[model samples]
Target: MTASPADAEAPLSAHHRKKQPEQVRRALLDCAAQIAAEQGASAITIQAVADRAGVTKGGLLHHFDSKQALLAAVFADLLEQMDREIDRTMAIDPVSRGRFTRAYVRACFSDRLLGERSLWGALSVAIVSEPALRSLWSGWLDSRMAQHAETDGDPRLVAVRLAADGIWLADMMEKAGGLKRYPQDFERVLLAMAEG
Candidate 1:
């Protein structure tokens, strides 16, 4: 016996609802990332993303209204992934917040899996608007840093942030081992500073 149209349609609708928005969001970001990685960030456009995702422009817009929103979504998604990874790493016994920072620095530098280049490109575009993206990104970073800075003084936080910045630069340059070449021995010194 053949299934009725109504029964077939019901399963399809159920499958659509079961489709995770987060998964779709990640796929969209991945497409944008691939485009940016190949031809730089300017290659990322609404049409390009839609084509890459095999979705119609209207469908893409349903999830992300504008190019700026899409770019921000990509950045925000990446940050969320990083936060989750850090959370897992910090689940270790006696995981101080500073250690988490250190782990983040190391991970961001060593693992290109985060697609840091594409993210940097996207971030540059987002921040050029100044008011819109900067506020969003700065708020997220500041909140995370502040949460870690609890009970610790500003000096330690600054030190840890500076260390993270250095790690970011080193990672961008593919100089993972060069952290050891710093004259002041930043990894050890910064850890001490954060702990103190």
Candidate 2:
């Protein structure tokens, strides 16, 4: 048998083929998220996601059994990313009440998290399907609120927390002019609350 020029590319092709499955799954999630961002949750179906991901429907199903599973995976990925960010922030800053709160608020309002429509849809699906997850989310927020209350006796901390949450909710809902209609002035309000 004689070797040809195509043989030289065989190794690279094999490497790509080996890694392509994971890449496809990632692409599916990313594309689905983008579609959800632009068109809303109704656009995030298995067929649409698979088509967007450029994979066969069978391939997508192998990664996610159902739409709910896909949504849960998305939420899990978002939370895991948040945890990594929180860990990084903690490593850089001393663990003070104010520092912790400020870092958290900064992280929440950071570009990575702001106006993340996919995460909101995923969170909504997860919350509806998994009550425990809802409790967990609520518990985390409540704990943070309690911590702020302990550090700052002002009732305004609750309002500040709620205001921050309102920002998130508005972003999630995709309500027109939400941010402009109820601007929270995050930096100014958060600093006053956390500094106290």
Candidate 3:
């Protein structure tokens, strides 16, 4: 038999031949997040995400039933990432009393959640305007609070978390407005509160 150009090429691997469902879903989510970060949540349309992910609209719809569902999933994914980051930060703390609160404070200051160009900043407006997204956020916060009821129940620690929330909002606003409204030591003050 004569060898042809096709015979010289290696066979395609299973990975190349077939796309895993999880991989496709993750790609869609990442594309949605990127679009939101760049152009705000309003830009996360089905066609946009599908096109960005290199998947057909039907493929994207297979993972998410609707645009609202996709947005919810993206919001949930961000919260899950934040939760993991908080857990990682908490693991390094030697103190157990306010460890969770301290981790939350650190996470609030982390780049993942801060700045206008970040996913959280881009989604903040949607979180406020969309009830579904807001509810998901509130549920996540409530679950975390309940989970750490024993270790982070101190009123002072709660105050620290509240302060961290303010700091995060202020930082987002500052970046969005191109102004410096918060003091340079705001994070330091919040961390100090977490220590108590």
Residue 13's lDDT in candidate 2: 42
lDDT of 1: 0.65
Q: What lDDT tens digits, residue by residue, belong to model 3 across residues 37-135?
A: 888889999999999999889989999999999999999999999999999988889999888888887777676334666888788778878999989
Give one digit per residue, the lDDT tens place, for model 2 in 1-196.
Answer: 8879888666664336655667777787788767766676556789998888777788889899988777656555566676677657756765455555565665656642344454554355446557655666776666655655655335565555566666666655554455565554654667567657
Considering TM-score, which of the candidate structures 1 and 2 is the better prediction for this target?
A: 2
Cα RMSDs, all models: 5.3, 4.7, 3.3
| Global fold similarity of model 2 (TM-score) | 0.67
Ranking by TM-score: 3, 2, 1
Candidate 1: clashing pairs of residues: none
Q: Any runs in candidate 2 off by more than 4 Å, and if so which? A: 1-20, 111-160, 170-174
- Which of candidates 2 and 3 reaches a greater TM-score? 3
TM-scores vs. true structure, each candidate: 0.66, 0.67, 0.86
Q: Indicate the residue-level lDDT of 72 in model 2.
A: 59
Clashes of each: 0, 0, 0
